[model samples]
Target: MTNEDFTTFPIDAVSQERLAAQGLRLGLVDTSDAAAFDAWLRADLRGFHQGDPSEKVLKEQREGLAYRRTTGVWDETVDEPVVPVATVNSWPANLTVPGGRTVPAWAISSVTVAPTHRRRGVARAMLESELRTAAALGLPLAMLTVSESSIYGRYGFAPAALAADLVIDTKRARWTGPVPGGNVHFIPNERFVDEVAGVHERYRLSSPGELPVWPLRWQQLAGLTGDDEARKRGLRTLRYADEQGETRGVAIFKIDGGDADFTKHTLHLEHLLAETDDAYAALWRFVLEMDLVSEVRAGLRSVDEPLLWQIADFRGVKAEVQEHQYLRVLDVPVTLESRSYFSDGAITLGVTDDLGFATGVWRVEVANGAATVTETTDAPELTLTVNQLSSVLLGGVRPSTLLRASGSPVPDGMDALFASDRTPWLSVWY
Candidate 1:
């Protein structure tokens, strides 16, 4: 990292040189400066099809985005040299792995390149700069929830966790799961932030590939961050209390539809978090038994959901599996040792990385709920690309399926060895 020539984040010499060769300037955004920050923010929203930001939104966003390490790329020849053509935002987050442990991972987001700057290697330079920034921070992994799936594989990133979008016909579905001993109470929307005490943190640690939710994300979901329309449509919030009078879960939703046909309402779930099975069952039961809604649609849920068996009619519940979060491993030794392995044995594996951050054959030995990985010169029993290796890091991706997709033979016991007790599911998109 070099800072003599740049203003904000220490310049990545590699990206600086790459873009400089193509007649562009690579620099960082000083978020404290209002003009630069607003320009970057507008360009980001424009990339996602949102129009320019108003003064009200800008005032709110000035505080909301102050914590991010923002970067951008500039084209001086354009009419507006003050506004960047490309933008990237990053921060450090705790990535929960298997066995209730967490490792610090770099989270990258708000990546956008101007349409006028296509085919100029701008995206590649920006992505490489992000990876280098992560490596410089000594982080073991980098993660992002992608909007475009096709652009990241070449950069050595692959989906490590999967989620489901569920649509259930409330008329046909009946709750046959455990009769909850808990009672659900409707609370005012403003009290949600104070009431949700450690529920997401506890639930996050219990699952692999989950990350901590920031304060801004919570504010947006609770309709506190200037979401006037969500309030206008009637946002309902519920809190569940168990038989022992313990608060265990929270849900936020809105039942929205046209008034002409009132029976065809759809319950759009915004957020749902339950710390216990009883709380989960009770919350879901409450959703499924709503009086007005005929259909319930929930997105970013676990692929292996317990609700599958809870419904009386399987035909009513529809779940579509989709990859949600992607991971890129930087330090193989630190990452491999952070999570506990299920099977106790030794496996010599080879990892080939184009970025050269993690390209080596290592001997992985697991025993007594711990793992020991060391470099080995011996031939690898199984060979996997860098992304393929990242896919198996969370223990959600089946190695056999990946190998078969590439027309390669599968190795025995590999699936069971990397299988996790709880599935890796990320409910929040960072």
Candidate 2:
């Protein structure tokens, strides 16, 4: 660990003092210290209702997570500081926005408050501290993929991207899309984990709301490490190579056939990534046309997935859309300027933020697919809460939808002005 690893947030003081009154110590974890890191890891797992990790797993995770800014609330009064009653961690991630522009984002995750510590304000303290620290660091945005949807709106976060959980009836979905000239081959798990970043990098640039994934998550997806290794023992991975012999796509999946029905096996797709449209069509057809797999289940897919139209029967593809990534805007001007717009227009936007990070009126002008924003005293043609503005920021959720929900007078042309050619999607949870 370097000096950067030892850095602590100044925002911790408020939580520290508040928790101290109740005999709790809120502080950062010295990740280089093995014992402390292990205890925190165990508490985090228990908080999520998972089994205590083995020592081997603990060591592996401690090394993997050493670089993150980890914080926890310790109650030394009970059992004297072995484990914390609450845990949270954060790291910087590049958030891809509309028009292929990327902005630095503070990614928060691994938030947990033990059941025994309910209603103690531990979660509130940690969350507030995180937001304050992120803004202090000069970050323009704060993002998190939520476990419970209802917990974050009060904090000025709204769902900016929608993900689809899909179950395709392979027997009825025939290959109707173009037959791309690419060969699909079975690849080893180790190779896919090492090579996936390149494929994902290409895909992420054009897909708004995608975040840079951690190597640990890639290992989990490739079945390299997990508590349930036995369940992943049968994992199979596939890669697609274009005619020019480049690895353009990958799919990690497994077949479950314990139902005692020989022809009704289910193929579950753990992860699928394709860099090219050709690769996408080929890999999907390979999965849908697999032998003995009557059904396939995949999650965290784009809401506007092309597979929906690739199948012959539209009803064969059953996709359920769910809110995935919730984004909170910290700087309205920075956010509006980073992304490109669809229609050229000028309008005043008024943002109402209780947190006070993004409460202001700004005139947004769009021309030649770029936007320029500046503070203005002009009246707003449309007014939105901080969360509401965040929802439509990426254009995945239409501004008109929220405008209708608010029953507020919004200018008509603003809806088309904020539209995106591609839908926003987060490939994996941070």
Candidate 3:
């Protein structure tokens, strides 16, 4: 990758020209300079608050709980100083993908380049720089919802998942017959963290496409990340456990209001994990029953989520479809073994690498819940590239689909091997 000329310090016109002539300079935006970048974001994006109390209030009261508990893509990487010229700063909202299970990936926020620094490749540099940084960080993948899809493909990022948003009226959400079961209670957000984990883990282990939430991610969700507004909003984690004391599901949300004397009760569900349809119905019923919350907003839900269908009055909900996270295979063997595959026995296959995840052939042995992957140059039955491998890895994009695509290699028995149980469906994005 060619280094860009842009640096932390302001560049002169002549220096800018020289840098532009050579190529753009790309670099990380140091954390020490976060304030500067924040300022740039506020100015560039009109209507954005200048870190005011109102924004804090909004965060504290409405958005803070979700940001604190919910894990989305915005992080230190997005702040990288080197800007690319092609950024749309579009801030596309929630997106959905239907692969057996519905997936919710929301990209509701973003910040781009300064006007003076525009046209010089700030956004492009920033975008590519973040991809490289994410790769180096060992993150399995990176994703963003975009109005301009053309911009991200150049950096080896692809649309791996999608989601849709829905607005429903409570009066329309007819509560069906309730299954007498787990008791629901209002608990402190921090106290309910474990319950949330328990429920989410149940789903995560069974779900093909969900990523494991790290400790720091939970901390962030609980408003424990030193974001003051989140604390003030009284953000609490809500959980429902069975009589045996096992947590079935949890929802993170708070009460909200606007200036127009509207009492808006929004539930920004950070994570809703339930194994059964009954558990899901009960949990959502609990939320809708909250006394004052008029409107409920839940983020990161799968498209065609059963909750909507479960509600008798489906029209009460309004939804918008959006893009969420994107995935790329960095290390083929490691990637294959990271998640559980359904193969019962061992098989020798010749794997191909078009995106350069790995080269030559590999022998992968799967037994029980374990797998052994080794490099092998010997002739084999199947051959496929990194992209194709990634598609098959999730089970959403079939091996047959990859073979059908132009330039993809054909392999015998590959379809049967991949079609074992069900195609993988990642319910969440990193």
- Please, what is the TM-score per model? 0.94, 0.96, 0.58
How would the candidate models be sorted by TM-score, starting from the highest?
Answer: 2, 1, 3
Task: Report the candidate with higher TM-score, 2 versus 3.
Answer: 2
Task: Assess the local accuracy of residue 231 in candidate 2 as a C-alpha lDDT between 0 and 100.
Answer: 61
lDDT of each: 0.85, 0.86, 0.50
Across 1-430, the per-residue lDDT of candidate 3 in tens digits comes to 1133212222234323443554543222332343433333334333222343334433332332222111111223335433332222211111211222322221312435444455655555455444333334443334454446666555444544446565556666766646638866667766766666666666664555555454444655767544476553667566776767666767676666644645555655555667666667778888776665666777666665777766777777778766554554555555555555555455565545433434557788776745587877677666655545545655555677657776656555565455424323344443
Cα lDDT of model 2 by residue, 215-328, tens digit: 888887887876777766879988899999898988989999738878899999988889899989998999999888899999999899899888899999888889999999
Task: Give the least accurate 10-residue stretch of model 2, judged by summed lDDT.
Answer: 1-10
Highest-scoring model, lDDT? 2
All candidates in order of lDDT, best leading? 2, 1, 3
Shift of residue 179 alpha carbon in model 2, Å = 1.6
Stretches > 4 Å off in candidate 3: 1-149, 167-180, 188-203, 212-237, 244-247, 253-271, 275-279, 288-297, 304-323, 344-385, 401-416, 419-430
Candidate with best TM-score: 2
Candidate 3 minimal-lDDT segment of 10 residues: 65-74
RMSD of each: 2.6, 2.1, 9.2
Candidate 2 has which clashing residue pairs, if any? Answer: none
lDDT of 1 by residue, 1-430 (tens): 2232222447689999999998899888888999889999888888777778787767677788778888889999999888889988888888988889888888999888988897778989999998988887787889999997898899999999999999999888888998788899998777776556367877789989889887667766777666376573488888898888777898989888848788789999887889999999999999998887899999998988898899989899898988888999988888989998888777898889999988999998888768899999999999889899889888999988898998977878788777788899898888
